[model samples]
Structure formats: C-alpha cells, structure tokens
Target: MPVELDPVKSAQKRSDYNGIYRLEDLTRLSEAVLSDSGQVDVMLKCTYDEQKLPVMLINAVTDVDVTCERCGQPMPLHIELAATFTPKTMRLEEDLVPSNYAIVEVNDYGLVDLRALIEDELMLEIPLVPKHEVENCAIKEQDMVWGELDKAAYEKPSNPFDVLKSLKNPK
Candidate 1:
C-alpha cells in the first residue's frame, strides 16, 4: 500500500508497513531531481513505535554514470544502502549531526510525512565520486587512448630551461 506522509494520522497511532513506495507519490521531491540518472529506485518499510514516534527503515538503490578522472571514460556505478529513521518532537537545529535517518514531529493529530522522509534518505545516499573498478571496465576506446597520450606527454619532459642549463654546463 502507498504511504502518504499525513501529518495528522501519523501522530495518532504508531503504524508499521512493508511495501514498495512509488516515486510519484513522493510529492515533496522535485521532478528534475528524481529524473537525474543517479536515482533509480527508493523503498521504505517502517513503523511507529509505542512511544508514538515514527521509525522508518529505508532501502535505496541508485545507478550513476560518471566519467573516469584518469581516463575520461563513462563509468557505470551502482549504490545500494539501508538505514533507519526516528521521529522526534524537538526542533531540529540547522547544523545538527548528519545522519541518514530523519526525525519528523508529530502534529496535533500525530501525523508524519513518510514520503518526505524517503526523499531525504535517497538524497543522503548519493556518492561524492561515482566511479567503477578498473580492469575489464566499460571505458571508451577513445578515452583510453587519450589517457595513454596524456601520460606519455607528462612523462616526456619538454623543459627548455633544463636543456639550456645542460648545454651550458656541458655535463
């Protein structure tokens, strides 16, 4: 079943569910952000504990395409992650501790926004550098050639100053 982040009902009774949440249902996230190649799928399974606080367990998998820094080749990367979230009543600070989980406040009806929570989890899972392993990798031939050329260029010194000094010193 689809879980909507109802701020009212969430505060009433602790709810737990196990299902696949659709990306379209998460209205809080911008469409452009979701369309990005890095995000593939996001799933959440969670429940509210006896204390009337929301507890979310999230599983997210994303596919990213990045260029190799060394070879300038497109690299396919996959990231899989899982985490837990706990809702709290305290006002979150602007610079609080960074965590994969999110805390949602229960409204008068004790409702929590499950969709928003899932979006947050997905955002946190993105990697800083998306790269694949070397050797038998899916790198473009042109990029590999460029990499070799670059390495050769660097290795072959064209230092005019050094050449002049050597000539003058006659060593």
Candidate 2:
C-alpha cells in the first residue's frame, strides 16, 4: 500500500515511513509504461528543519519499460527521485518557502497525499522521448524516413501555353 500521512503532524513527531507502490496504483504512470507489473520503493521522512519549518524528504526508485520512440519497441527505463519539500499552507507562504526545498501544498485538513506526490515526481522523471542507446536501438538514424517525393507527382505537367506555341510555330 502507498503511504499517506499528515505532513505537519508527522513533521512534529519526526516520523518516517517506507512503502512500495504497485505500478497499477499509479493510474497516470501506468498509462505511460509498457508493462503493468512493477513497483516503486518509496521512503518519506518528515521533520522540522533548523528554520522551524516542517519539511519532508522523499526518495523513490522504480524500473519500468517504455516504448522506444525510435524503434517502437519496449526499452528499459529506470526512474529515481530525491527531493526535499516544505508544506505550504497558504498562497502567502509560497514566497517564504526556501528555494532549496520544493513546496507541496497542504489541504484544508493539513494533510498531503504522499502517494500522489511520488507518482507525480516519477512522471516528471520519465523522458519525453524514451529510447534505447544508439548502439542498442533496432532502428538507426540512417533508417529513419523523413519523407519521399513521388516520381509521378514531381513529373513536369504539360504546359497549356505549349499548344498555342505549337500552332504559332506550325509544329
């Protein structure tokens, strides 16, 4: 099961949680992956920083297969995430959040869904165009087809003015 806890409360107690999220649990990420069976190892620690701000440290890792854009075949992709985030209770706090730590929004109940957060972070780590290395991809750059001109389409069309010229020249 995925981990979900109150960031502020957990931080006050300096709590730590470790869990695994099945790929299927992440609906958005599952759609982008080639295989349906996999799991992400997640570790979350909530504590008060020296500035008296509640922060959470997150670490997540996963291995999955994504379609190679070049060859249209499945390729292995490893995703790793490490981030520090301070809970933002109000829009005004956005400016107060330190630049070194990311800001995660807290709900009216002061709870932040760690499962969704990890899924979102994983999605961001995925490459826009997943592909195997040049030496490994079945399709190479030289094999790519940009386009080809049709021989019939490129043939010069008969000029309408040619008839008039032929009549004037008696040819």
Candidate 3:
C-alpha cells in the first residue's frame, strides 16, 4: 500500500513505520521479468538530527525476476538495501551531513511519499548488470568463444617508430 507522511511531524515524533508494498505498484522501476509471487518489505523510521533536520532511515528487501545475462533465462534476485535520507534545508550545512546519507529536496508541501522513496532506493540497489552464477548459467563454454589467437599465429607487428628509424638510417 502507498504511504504518505508529514516530514516535520513524523521526524519530531521519531515515528516507526513497517509495511510491505506490492512490487507491481512501482511503475518507475526498470522493467524486469517478475516472478508471480514477489513483495517489497520495508521498515522506515523518521527522526530528527540534533539540529532538528528531518531524517529518514530505511531498511528494505525486495524480490525481483531478472533475466540472466549469460543464459537469457529468468531468475529471481533478492535485493536487500539500507538508506539514509535527510531533507535538504538551508539551515543544515552540507558538510554536516554524513557521507553515507543521501540528501533529498523535499517538496514545497512538506509531505513525503514513503512508498516512493523506498521504491527508488530499492531500484538503485538493483544490479546495473545481472548475471547468473557461472555454474548455474545454462550457456556452456563451447557455446561462446572469446577471441584467442593460436600460439603459432601470434606475431608482433613492427614498432610504429620503425618507419622513422629507417628514414633516419636510410638503410
């Protein structure tokens, strides 16, 4: 289900939110071959820094179906990720922010979409390139070949500077 919260109020109270969102609900995510049964589980906590800047801590796991780059077969990937988000504020110096935390520019309405934030985080955690384990891949070594020169055929070409050397020597 979608979740929305007031950033200021939630942070002040240090609210704890735990819920599961349907994977189908995230439209902005890259398209993957989804398993019939998959879910996004999340635990979101809101707190304020010493300076009263709102911060969000997220813990989440999601299941997604992805094609194996090697075998071209669909496989399930369990993605686990954690993230920290602080609403950007004029009062908060960027240097004060921890390297691990990401800054978000909250909308003018001061409302945050909890589901969307977590969804975006999970998306980022997904691998840029997905591949099945070598042993698990259906493709065999014989099926694919990387260029390999026969030892006898391996011969080095003359150096590019050879022409200049010969020109100087005139031999």
Candidate 4:
C-alpha cells in the first residue's frame, strides 16, 4: 500500500514499507509527465540514528517520457531518488538536525506522506532542458545555425573603417 505513517511512531517502532505508487495519483507530477501510466517503486525505513534522532530513509525509482527540448520529440527519462530525512517536530529544532539528513516537516498529525515526498523528489530529478544524446538527437549542432550567411558580406573588399583613416590623416 502507499506509505502514510506517523514519523514519530514509525521511528519508535522501526517501521519499514516497500510498495509501488501510481504516477497518475501524483497530480503535479502527472501534469509534467508525457504520460501518466507508470509506477514508482518505493522503499522506506524509519529509525533513529546514533544520536537517537528520529529519521527516515527513502529510495524510489521510476521512468517517464519527456519532450526533448532539441527535437521536441518524446524521450524516455529515468528518475531515482535516495534521501535521508529527519522529522521536524515541535520539540526538534531545525539547527539541531544533523547535516547529513534533510529536514522534513510533519503534518498536523505528525505523519509523513511518502507519496508526496516521492512526487517532490521525482519532480526535482526532471532536467530543466531535456535532450537526447548528440548522436541520437534528430537536430544536430550544425543544423542549429540560421540561414546561410550573406557571401557578399565577406566578399566585399572595401573597408568601412577607411573613412576613419581618412579623417585621421586627411591627405
């Protein structure tokens, strides 16, 4: 089942969850993806560290199709997220959290929604300018240039700066 557990309680109990979440369920992610027909494999574990601080470690993997910026064609993209987070509770100060673990806010019920977390991480993994490899892309670097340059521009022998030279040495 989709993970939605109280971080504080889960940490105390040392809970673990592994499952698949539908991409279509993630509204924001679905909108950005080319097709909302995929699943994210999620593995989550909640426990305390050496410092006895409640923390959760999560890993997720998924694939989506994104429009290539270069050719505007659909290209497959893989996403993976592996992160450790410390639950931020009223008693836990942000500064006290360990540097290695990111701080995650708890809901009103002190629960951590794994689906939302996966969605956020997956969104971040998407590239700002998606593109295929140079060899595989339909549009090439050479083809990116605009229409051919005017041959007359380069062939013209007369120098426009000659007028300046004449002004400097008015013979």
Across 1-171, the per-residue lDDT of candidate 3 in tens digits comes to 337767667888888888888766776654554553567888888898766668888899877888887788987788897888887766768997888889876667877777788778787787777888767778877776688777767777669998899899985
Q: Using alpha carbons, what is the TM-score of model 3?
A: 0.77
Candidate 3 C-alpha error for residue 66, in Å: 0.4
In the order shown, what is each candidate's alpha-carbon RMSD?
A: 7.7, 4.9, 5.3, 5.7
Tens digits of per-residue lDDT for model 2, 44-129: 88898887888899999999999999889899999999999888775335766678898888777877888888899999999999
lDDT (Cα, tens digit) per residue for candidate 4, span 1-171: 455678778889998988889988988998998999999888888899987888889898999999999899999999999999888877887777778788887788888787787789889999999999988898987887677777886785999899999999987
* Residue pairs clashing, model 3: none
Q: Is candidate 2 or candidate 3 better by lDDT?
A: 2
| Best by the TM-score measure | 4
Give me candidate 2's TM-score against the actual structure.
0.80
Off by over 4 Å in 3: 33-37, 50-52, 147-171
Q: Which pairs clash (backbone N, Cα, C closer than 3 Å) in model 1? A: 5-113, 7-111, 10-110, 10-111, 11-110, 11-111
Rank by TM-score, descending? 4, 2, 3, 1
Off by over 4 Å in 2: 1-3, 90-92, 145-171
Please identify model 4 stretches exceeding 4 Å from their true place. Answer: 146-171
Candidate 1 runs further than 4 Å off: 1-4, 7-40, 49-52, 90-116, 136-171
Per-prediction TM-score = 0.47, 0.80, 0.77, 0.81
